[model samples]
Target: MTEYNTVLAPVLSAFWDQPNSWTLETYLKNGGYEGLKKAFAQKPEDLIQTIKDSGLRGRGGAGFPTGMKWGFLPPADGGPRYLVVNADESEPGTCKDIPLMMAAPQFLVEGVIITSYAIGSNHAFIYLRGEVVHVYRRLLRAVEEAYAAGYLGKNIQGTGFDLDVTVHAGAGAYICGEETALLDSLEGRRGQPRLKPPFPATAGLYARPTVVNNVESVASVPQIINRGADWFTSMGTERSSGNGLFSLSGHVTRPGQYEAPL
Candidate 1:
């Protein structure tokens, strides 16, 4: 048995017993918007720097730097840009985003807002796997709660930045997890991988500048913004810093999320 370090998840077990844990009221009481307050205090570029400093790498199969990805976009010039969250996490040995969405979905909402502000995008879309109906319902409920709580929708929390996030569940297909294939699925076509060289960051999803990232990658931003970069970079290896949730499955003593530094 070749064992590896399995890291724990943050919001997965954050609140077990509480009326409407997915509701805005519960998330607020549990120190949810505190990160937004901190995020709004800093300039957008500075927010990106904070994430870079945190050394928060992507949690999906790809360990790309979250901050650097956000910084790659050119300045908006009266054109539309989009943030596409790849919730279609169907890696053979992966199982994280669904549970996180089911347990504490507000963490994702916070991440979306902070990321939208940083990338100058007022609209975002989450492409979830269609096989899990329960998770889809839970995510829909979370979106409604965030909208009702003034964290989403027009003039967010008195800031001029406005964002609208939609949860899009894709038809069941494993190939859709590929960045270009997912984009094709999102655009209502057969799921197939498009040619690279023009990655999704450049021309993607209706021929606009789009950032397609994994669900866990999108959800990790709020904490990086709140804790500052130095605090985040303290863990992990030289190339891969920061703590992450690693899931060990099959015949294991305890098959759950465990936290470890790379």
Candidate 2:
């Protein structure tokens, strides 16, 4: 039998087994928003650099560098930019994101706030899979809780940083998992991939610069901000740094989600 004893590193899943793990109160008690406070201390560009230094790749397939993806946006015009979280986990056998949303949604919420602030976005969206009504409801409630705590909305934490987050449910198209397709679906159009050249960074979501990141990718940002780049680099390989959630199922005695170094 292969041993995962020392290989497992459960940063995101660390508290899933605890009582009321989804509640804001529980999240606060366990050093939840400390990362945002740290983020607020740094310049937005520096925040992006930190992720680059951490070597944190996208957990939503493709392994794209998360920081580089953020840096790809053209300098801010006087127009609206957006940060969209792709919560539509519809690929066959792909199950990590849904469970993360259901069990510890605050993690994604905190990550969204920090990401929006870093990217100079006044608005953000979580595009969820339509069939998961329960996850959608949980995400909505989490957003409401965040707003009440002043972690979202106008003048957040008195820093004069305002952000509004919208939770949108898709029609459950598997293609919507693709970033461009997800943007189209979010805009009330049919979910289909668009031709490139004017990639999402150049033009997206109402024809403005936009960033679409996966649930796990955004959720991992809080830890990178809080723990420092070197800490994240200590895990996984030199190329693929940091840990990720691995969904194991079908023909396995211990089939479940495991968070460990990539």
Candidate 3:
């Protein structure tokens, strides 16, 4: 019988097994925010282009190129734009986002900062599923840790880029997994999908230009920012490049999150 690859790729899951892995100190010690540091050195547009050239796609079923989605936003217009993280991973076969946030919350946090910078967003939100109270508490603490470390506040790393992250939990609903519904639920309304045309890019979250991306998509930003587009494109196929977390379930021997080329 042929044997499948047993070794894990382990990019986002690299430090998951470390004791105190969820803490800011642990994350920083393991080269956590270096991606954000490198991102600050470069212009936001350049960063977007790098991601575009990398061919990284959204892992939230759409498989849309992540960089392209960012490019779709209209000009900044000097007004506020927002980045909403779709952490409500309620899809049938989706389980990567929660575990990622639980094991290495910094990955998502760092990704949020970079994506916010790339898209000119000062405020970002993580809309989590409310039923997972433990996960919610873990993420809340993670955000607090990030703030105390100067990673999520004014003049981050002396780069003059100010940002604030909010962790919001949704009143469990599969429909909220839809980006628009998630936004509505986030706004304290009953969870329901909104009509399209005025897409989130144009008007979202209090009628502001918004980029709603899945947790994995946002989490992938740090790696692309730190490693470069060329490195990201080295994995997967020509069109679908880079690696991602595969949610494995069932009676399989090593069932869990598996990181592999997409």
**TM-score against truth, every candidate:** 0.91, 0.98, 0.96
Which stretch of 10 consecutive residues in model 3 shows the poorest summed lDDT?
1-10
- Per residue, candidate 2 scores C-alpha lDDT tens digits across 49-135 of 999999998888989999999999999878999999998898788799999999999999999999998889999999999899999
Task: After the best TM-score superposition of candidate 3, give how far the Cα of residue 112 lies from its true spot, in angstroms.
Answer: 0.5
Q: Where in model 2 is the C-alpha error above 4 Å?
A: 1-3
lDDT of 1 by residue, 28-57 (tens): 888887889999888999998888777777
lDDT of 1: 0.81
For model 3, residues 39-135, the per-residue Cα lDDT tens digits are 9988999999999999999989899989989988899799999999999989776689989889899899999999999999999999999999988
Which residue pairs collide in model 3, if any?
none
Worst 10 residues of 2 by lDDT: 1-10
Error of 1 at 224 (Å): 1.0
lDDT of 3: 0.90
Winner on lDDT (2 vs 3): 2
**Candidate with better TM-score, 1 vs 2:** 2
